[model samples]
Target: MNEKTEELRDIFTNVTDGEETVTESQTATRGSLEKDERTIDERLENVIAQMRERYAFETTLTDEELIRVAKGFYDDVSDEDLASELEVSSEDVFDARLSLHLVESEADAPDIDLAAIRERDAADLDALADEFDASEPQIRRARRVAAAQDESRAANDRYRDEFDSILGDSELTERIASDVREDGLEDATEGMETDVSL
Candidate 1:
């Protein structure tokens, strides 16, 4: 090779530290289809520990019960069902849900005004229930939902955030979506045959 070319090669080698291959580390969690890595319950237990360290507990539920609540919430289990399993009042489950930030947007009744209940969060439950023509449970639920939503608006809902962080990825998702559109959904969902082509 010419002297000029040899010098250019030397410069390139220096820049790359003489390594020809470049590799990037994959994300921490595996993709959805991977098998036998870690059970969802085990993973959730770990996440719950991390979250508890970051935030204080205000609910009456024990640490073990908190894990059950987090697991049940992720499994899409209803509060009433969790209450039955835990042998606790639905009110306790509701309180734990708020403590863990596992709240979903819901109203107590169709005509219930969340804004009105939010303003009365500290007011007497009996008076609010009477005024709204709702049960004490309904008023309690409305207050929790309203407060959680209001807080979620100002910051990310960490529990829902846990799902996306623990199970999804934005950059990889976009790239995969683009590739699927370019390749066609049928080939992706059903395996493409090599012999069949346009």
Candidate 2:
């Protein structure tokens, strides 16, 4: 590469070297590197690496099996977390999840009854609070929502973020928008019951 191109590369390295923040002077040049530096594949790989570092929980299962097991463990965890648990790449986790859906479709795996789980979680949390002999209002409130619900709160959060991104404008007047809002309201009331029965 030429001098300018080489200089750009050095700048990118500096930017990603865990610098505090991007300054105004670097913004324009930074944009070019940001646009070109990480491809979808590379970013995805990095995500997988980060995930693996985060969840490394104990499990003897293979990546694919581990993903399935992890899902059963919690409905709210990101596939990245699952990937980490399974000691695999996020892409692998994605593929495994897709396969799970396909198999679920064939087997008619019952859609999770999130409402029931939430109610159960609440009950369990209540019991735990009683058993512990001390109850904080905040703890009671949170427990009431997920006393026994499948650990899918994280998943629900992800979906919420994704939904918001897709919706973009918050101005909701359209019928579809109304429906979406209604669904979200119901979900909230149900305490993260996004894993409804299929």
Candidate 3:
């Protein structure tokens, strides 16, 4: 319907007739179509390259956000096309889809009582997991994460208590801190030679 489309149609038509001689006009149209197609392809490639660069360095997009974007990209483009556009493997795309499902499932999961979990034996935990209709491994992972957090909190409390005890003697604390700073500075500068004559 457009000039270029008509020209392309004509080129294809001429090709189907194997015995027909290609006229100068048809030859020129064919070249023009190829050039135009190349330009369009180059533009598309440039855009995809820019998108890939931005996506790679974008720190604001969380895993969930990235998963959603990957899903959207996969839906709109073929696996090979999406992989080429994103400069990643098809396996990476599959992984993103899997991550999206995992994140969604995690979001839909019910909250567990971590304190009650800490009190429970292994058998009790398995029973609790059954009661919650969750997998034992999932419950175990949550419990492990919660226990690690509790351990971190306890370590922080101990550090705070130690610091408080140290601070109770202000003069001794200041002297000790000053000595540590001086020692650190000396060690840091030990390997470096400075020209102070100028």
Candidate 4:
């Protein structure tokens, strides 16, 4: 009976010892996982802080400075070097390069002068159209509008000359001219038909 009691006690002790060992192993693993997670969080926070600093610095640059930095990037400078020099991120340097390229392309485009186009003669306009690789109809339309304006000015000048010529004549002659103009005799004469049947 004493031997049986001792064997039972040893079995109970062994089971408890196995449970304690497993619990300790589990606790150690959990602690290790928590430490790894904390390290990762710290590293991520540090990277985020650095990114914020770079963004703030990049935003402070003027457009001219950005263009200069972009130019330097295109001039074969390394991205890391440019970022260090400009105190901005490599991403910001890439964006500056794109913006500078857009600005330069717009600047390189030719400016159109519609007024100058309107003043050019048909032959000159055709030449211009050929030079600009434009369609003939567009050139013709500009020429037509310019010609119409010219005609209108010439008509105004003729009327002014007529009025001046009449101003130097007698009052009776001026009245006759005025009456003829008001009666539309100039237009009437052009449309009149002569009757030859008697």
Candidates in order have lDDT scores of 0.70, 0.43, 0.49, 0.48
The true-versus-predicted C-alpha distance at residue 162 of model 1, in Å, is 0.8
Error of 2 at 176 (Å): 24
Which tens-of-lDDT digit does each residue in 17-102 have in candidate 2? Answer: 95545676554442121233544334433433444454442333344464353334234566577678767786565444432221
The sequence of per-residue lDDT tens digits that candidate 3 reaches over residues 139-179 is: 87556545544543654534223323322333454567788
Clashes in candidate 4: how many? 0
Q: Candidates' TM-scores?
A: 0.52, 0.25, 0.25, 0.20
For model 4, residues 54-173, the per-residue Cα lDDT tens digits are 333324455445544534533557656888887888656644443222112222223433456665665786687886676666565444444433443544534223322332233445
Candidate 3 lDDT for residue 14: 81
Give the distance in Å from residue 50's predicted Cα in candidate 4 to where it truly belongs: 33
Once fitted onto the true fold, the runs of candidate 3 whose alpha carbons sit more than 4 angstroms away are 1-110, 157-198
Model 3, poorest ten-residue lDDT window?
99-108
Please report, as a residue range, the 10-residue window in candidate 4 with the lowest summed lDDT.
100-109
Q: Residue 79: error of model 4 in Å?
A: 2.1
The better candidate by lDDT, 3 or 4, is 3
Number of the candidate with higher TM-score, 2 or 3: 3
Q: Which pairs of residues collide in candidate 1?
A: none
Q: Go through the candidates in order and give the clash count of each.
A: 0, 12, 0, 0
